[model samples]
Target: MNALTVNLRSVLELTDEQFFQLCQANRDLRFERTATGELIIMPPTGGETGNRNARITQQVMNWTDADGTGIAFDSSTCFKLPNGADRSPDAAWIQLARWNALTEAEKEKFPPICPDFVIELLSPSDSLKVAQEKMKEYIENGVRLGFLINRKSRQVMIYRQGKEVEVLESPATVSGEEVLNGFVLNLAMIW
Candidate 1:
């Protein structure tokens, strides 16, 4: 299903705590906040999408465990971006130093720092244009590397800071490059 965006700036402005409480109350639903204060309600992904997402997250988690240089986060974790937007990427990783910098209280709420690496897998109901825009926003907010994987199209759009996006079509695998050290994502399971 497509995401629904609601502009509640006039009726009510949700503070950070209010938004967090709202999310906690609605445990089954996923929500996001735009930089402009709009609310986004995202529907749950289908079984196929969920399965693929699990594989992707598992790979990243394994890498993080072995690399010992960063922490991996699943899709359910929302981050409070530098630009005031609350976003949740499919799979994300933050450097150890950056994560250690946050106070215990800061870690209790939505993280206030952008991830060092992010992955957004396009599901059947996802919009490619919208996903691309989100990737750009991640880079602009200090993400070092990102992958927008469109499984239907078998295309992976690589996003890096200060560089043009690179598109790879039907690739067997995608490397994490220097960002994740020796990490490489195998596409066989995803495809």
Candidate 2:
């Protein structure tokens, strides 16, 4: 889905509570908060995009479930990165140790931690530049691994810590590498 970014820093700074309340009151739109306090208002995905996102999330969740090493999250779950940015990756997984360290109250709100792995599936309306920026932000926030998948161009930009991004063209699948251990995402459904 395409997102409408509102630069509220010029108008007024919103407290964490205010941002949380605003998000809760507008359940129709998906929201994200940047480290700079900009609000990203994303529209609901179209049917095709929604189905693709679901498949991606299901695949990741299946691996996480069987591996029993981490917890999987869908698009609706937001994570408050250590840098203070609230982001919602299309598919994400945090290591069991990291997740267990969170207090119950923190878990109830946006967990203040970065996921070990994250996936962003590009919808038709999504801007590639914006998505790339988001992926970079994830990496800067300490995400160990991230994937920016573009079905239109059949390309995937792979991001890993301490390495330059690796771009693939028309790949049939994406490997989880050492970070995800045994997880290998099958791209047939999403592609």
- Candidate 2, 105-160: lDDT as tens digits: 98988888899999999999999998999899999989999999999999999999
Candidate maximizing lDDT: 1
TM-score for candidate 2, residues paired by index: 0.97
Total backbone clashes of candidate 1, pairs 3 or more residues apart or in separate chains: 0
lDDT per residue as tens, model 1, 106-165: 889898999999999999988999899999999999999999999999999999999999
Q: Report the Cα RMSD per candidate.
A: 0.6, 1.0
Candidate 2: worst-modelled 10 consecutive residues by lDDT: 1-10
Best by TM-score: 1
Error of 2 at 10 (Å): 3.0
Task: Give me the runs in candidate 1 sitting further than 4 Å from their true place.
Answer: none
Clashes of 2: 0
